[model samples]
Target: MLDRLAHSRGLPQVIRTDYGKEFCGRAMVVWAHVRGVQLRLIQPGKPSQNVYVESFNSRLRDEYLNEHWFPTLLNARTEIERWRREYNEDRPKKAIGGMTRAAYA
Candidate 1:
């Protein structure tokens, strides 16, 4: 997902994320190093540094997850894929001057 975001906007010089396994795994570090994309890790138990994504999670949940229910994993995946598209393309965001995510991109 970070790669997708970076590619869409152009290669970012750096990225900040938590110390969770997904972000701290060897593979992820290797990939970031190879790409010259600095990975800034927030200290464990300190969340204020990652407030951007933490805040976005609330919005994502409210606008997408809260609006739908799924009977199966496949169904959920499909709906999420479609919802993500619309959210990225049409949903307005305050972070980007109140423009849709794609528009801001």
Candidate 2:
């Protein structure tokens, strides 16, 4: 994913997420720092403060995982890639004033 992000059309300035142990680890922190990407991690146990991502996660699970069970990590990755494109380019978002996130972006 880091490779994907680095090669993204336009580099993003800030990325916000929940401070799970995986992201809170020194490795991730250092990686973000080295890449000059700002990582905005919400306080643990305060999910409402990160409502957008939380809701996104819920919707992602509902829209994809609940419908199809992957047999392996590779299948899951493929499913995720498919959904991510639709989510960004097609799905309308309230935060973007009802425009698709891709349109807003």
> 11-105 in candidate 2: lDDT tens per residue?
56777778777877898788888878799988878999888778879989898889998899998999899998998899888877999976787
- Per-residue CA lDDT of model 1 for 1-105, tens digit only, reads 667877799777888998889999998899899889999999899888899787767777998899888999999989988877886788888778899877776
| Model 2 clashing residue pairs (backbone) | none
lDDT of 1: 0.85
Model 2, global lDDT: 0.83
Per-residue error for 55 in candidate 2, Å, reads: 1.1
Model 1: residues >4 Å from true position, as ranges?
Answer: 1-6, 71-78, 81-105
Error of 1 at 31 (Å): 0.7
Please give the CA lDDT of all the candidate structures. 0.85, 0.83
Estimated TM-score for each candidate: 0.63, 0.71
Query: Residue 37 CA error for candidate 2 (Å)?
Result: 2.4
CA-RMSD of model 2: 2.8
